[model samples]
Target: MTKIKIKESKASTSIPTANPENLKKQHRKKKRKILWKNKVKHVGKKKEDTKAMRVLPPKAPQEFSSNWKTLQELLKQKATSFDKSLPVTQTYSKNHTSKKENVKGIPAISGGGKMGKFKSVNKMDCDPAQTSVPLATLKSERTATDKNSTEGKGNSKEHKKRKNSDIEKEQADIKHKRRKSEEHMEQHLEADIWFDDVDPDDIEAAIGPEAAKVARRKMGIEDKPQLSVEQVLVKEKAFAGLTKAVAMDCEMVGVGPQGEDSILARVSIVNQFGKCIYDKHVKPTEKVTDYRTAVSGIRPKDLKKGEEFKSVQKEVADILKGRILVGHAVHNDLKILFLDHPKKKIRDTQRYKPFRKEVKSGRPSLKLLCEKLLNVKVQTSEHCSIQDAQAAMRLYTLVKKQWEANINAKSKRKCVA
Candidate 1:
């Protein structure tokens, strides 16, 4: 009886079923898209991390792997142009091994299967630590070794002699390069030798108008550039270290008959920074036979307002005590002052072997050294003891490291003995 109302419906009564194969295809496509997006995100994050890590301090070997990989990549790229053969290492054995014995092969990739959980067993064999020596390099090295072995088969002594000669040539080339480098350094350091602290008026009064003009330009009296905080700090630090070292030069006036024997007339001392620390004219005990007006710049009036010789000597001794004394012909200065300083405590620019080598003279004068190494001409007219002292100090500063090292080494040896 319900068939009377159950006319044919427009919509399908049976539930529509999805195709299993189609469903599987759609699912795989969705999964593939998701995986691609995740991979891109992961790579972007890794790149960002690498960029951030660049500014940080280098991590310990165990703490970093990405940096090691980057270094390896750089080395690999450089190897294309700057390929260098690795030095061969030999292992002494009871059974003598052949010189051309093959390097032990790196073990194959281990712990790489499903059973191994895909974890690396040999850490050193990992990508970061693995040797990236090119196949071509190995082949070339093998051929080179073979060639050497064959060549030395008959004339080993001649080969050895040739090798020794090559080594000697290499040493000579190294020495030449070193000499050139030192000359270059001297040229560059020329600007640093100028006495910046010396007053223009003093230069004019002591030397001449020409030197004073040069000093004015160098000192930048009119157009001195404002120094930044960093520069000022650096300058202060440099000058602070100069307190331990001082340079002295004494102007002598001839006292004995024939005007040969000299006595100190004017003494000038400067610090490492070329700043005058002590300057005073001394009233000599012996009567002056020759004032040496042209060289010493010590006029009769200048010595009229001079300090007593005994007082000057005591003051100089106090200042020089436990301090490095640098000067040209320092022994002569000490002799005239009637003071004794430890030989090790003195740095004589005149006797310095390197300075002598530079001038190519047995005893290079301070003026010659100043002109040659410092590129500053001094003693133009009247010799200024202050200027001479500054020159000696600058020369000492040039080889300060080597000079101190020699003194320290000698002292250490003496102590040990």
Candidate 2:
């Protein structure tokens, strides 16, 4: 009775449940296949192409929509500044193809999408990259120079030319010279020249006063200051340390106004700095008066006959050359000397006497200055070379101090600094 009514039932087929493990295994196999494919690509031509395809900075994403059209414009723009090598390829095809050939097309693009706008893509399309100096900039630099400046030259060439000129001038200045010039040049160098270890035979032995009578002469010597002046400037340090002030007490034969009566006899040079470089009893040019034996001390027996004044001129000049000149009145001493010896660089304490207002004027005697200033008498018994040199040196330093003080005051700098 329960089965009286027969009802037909249509059942829908149910989908089988997926096995996650089988799905996982299949997915792993697919992943392995993809990985193997990539590995092969990495090991093959892709590796070789890396060295050939130099990496470039990424291109900016397309900024404009019709970017395909800009490729031709860009190419043309680039070509204007570079060598042109374009291959406009045209392909002809089958029936129903239009008689008109199509030029290479620039790929079209839509903007605002994930894909950026594209450029021309054809069989003949090629990437371009070449480097060169900008012609406009190079031309601008050339125009700016225009011979007013050396654009392409090295600075070394100019420096070498100037250096050579300086060298040539130096070489030319060294060849020629004169006697007076040499003396002036070495005026500041006299003290530096040494006489140590010289031959003893050069030393002279002469009687008092007569022994030092022949000390200066007017022999021919050049007069050029340039050589020695430059040398002093270059070597001032050598002269600066010379504390020894050498003085020459020169005695010359008396001369008349016309200088015709050349009574050349005795000349002496005594270095006031305890040095006696020269002392000689020069034979007289003319016969001596018999009355001079006691005072002049020239005995007829001791005189050497035929001793020319010219023969002894050089001996005297050398003695007086570098040292300071001192006497009662050095003017008379020089006047007597210039008759034979050239008046080179000679310093007279007498000329500086005017500065010593306390000292008597009108050629005060050397003994008087020594007695007053130094509290010592000179030439009382015998003319002492060392004593006279000391007096002259003292007088020089006193004057020098005054001069230095004046210079420091003018410059507003400390003296002896």
Q: For each candidate, give its TM-score against the true structure.
A: 0.43, 0.32
The alpha-carbon lDDT assigned to residue 378 of candidate 1 equals: 77
Clashes of 2: 27
lDDT of 1: 0.72
Error of 2 at 63 (Å): 99
Q: Write the per-residue lDDT of candidate 1 for residues 259-334, one digit (tens) a residue.
A: 7999889888888787778999998788888999998998889888999999999999998999999999999999
Error of 2 at 129 (Å): 99
TM-score, cand. 2 vs. native? 0.32
lDDT of each: 0.72, 0.46
Candidate 1: the clashing residue pairs are none
